[model samples]
Target: MENWSENHNDFIDYERDEKNKKIHILIIYDISENKTRTKLVKFLLGYGYRVQKSAFEAIVTKSQLKKIIKNISNYLDEENDSIRIYRMYYDDVIIFGKNFSIEDEEIIII
Candidate 1:
């Protein structure tokens, strides 16, 4: 999660968006080392809920997201690890499953 990710562009401050407004961030990581991965997970957990085994979703301010990226970068081995972060809206998400509910909401089984 840096300025060089091919899957994402640089973190841009949208001109239309207000400064300090909170936004949803989805972070998914694949690290080769278990220790590093575990540490990253622990750090991320303090910021948001874990959506899956290796993914986390947080509602953080732009500065908070930037801080996360800055701090986590130190623990990353870019040659062997991959971490992707996306900015999205919580309402845009739809679920289709059982036994999994975000923020204690009921899960829809279809």
Candidate 2:
């Protein structure tokens, strides 16, 4: 298994140009400005669910991910804010937790 370093790109690349395949993404961030953080939260809600006060989980394609990253890069305070993104395929992860609910691209209409 290959690990990532600061000098290396750690993002995933599926064979056969699987840009349309949906994958899980975890986004965590910390911003010093309240207004910026709040705005970012609102923006991210369109793409995923908020799993924590400062963390979110999203299922998106490679193109959507690129767009999300690009949009957020504009206002991020690189010197005072920090953000991390982790991606995993459905079969690439194992979960062990308490009362965890899975969020898929499902629509529940009553």
Candidate 3:
């Protein structure tokens, strides 16, 4: 079998173009090791806003999502760590606290 990492670029490009739409992604992860968890959280902070201690929300393109997953996977211990990415439509996401909102056309990450 071919290695997934080897073919990921092609897959990312094709799917990104075909699905050229913005998506709301919620990332949640649990890591037992402090160093790894800190590294993962810092990495994620570069891509999204932290909504909670261990959760984040971002408006991302398909390509960005693919990249995020591929990069974050490197920090995970397959047997001990867990990461959950939830994809939701913009309109389908409802927020009830802190007035959190995602822009339709863009996300300005400072």
How high is the CA lDDT of each candidate model? 0.69, 0.69, 0.72
Evaluated against the true structure, the overall lDDT of model 1 is 0.69
* Alpha-carbon RMSD of each model: 7.5, 6.5, 4.1
Q: Which stretches of candidate 2 lie over 4 Å from their true place?
A: 1-12, 16-20, 90-100, 106-110
RMSD of candidate 1 to the truth, in angstroms, is: 7.5
Candidate 1 similarity to native, TM-score: 0.74
lDDT tens readout by residue for model 1, 27-63: 9999999999988988887777888898888777666
Candidate 3 residue-wise lDDT, 1-110, digit = tens: 23344565554444434565665778899998999999988888777788888888887776677778667777789889888877655667667778655554555444
- Residues 30-79, candidate 2: write the lDDT tens digits: 88999999888888888888877888888876666666766775547988
Error of 1 at 67 (Å): 0.4
Instruction: For candidate 2, report its TM-score.
Output: 0.71
Query: What clash pairs does model 2 have?
Result: none
Clashing pairs in 3: none
- The best-first sequence of candidates by TM-score reads 1, 2, 3
Q: After superposition, which runs of candidate 1 have C-alpha atoms over 4 Å from their true positions?
A: 1-12, 15-20, 98-110
Look at candidate 1 and tell me the lDDT of residue 98.
40
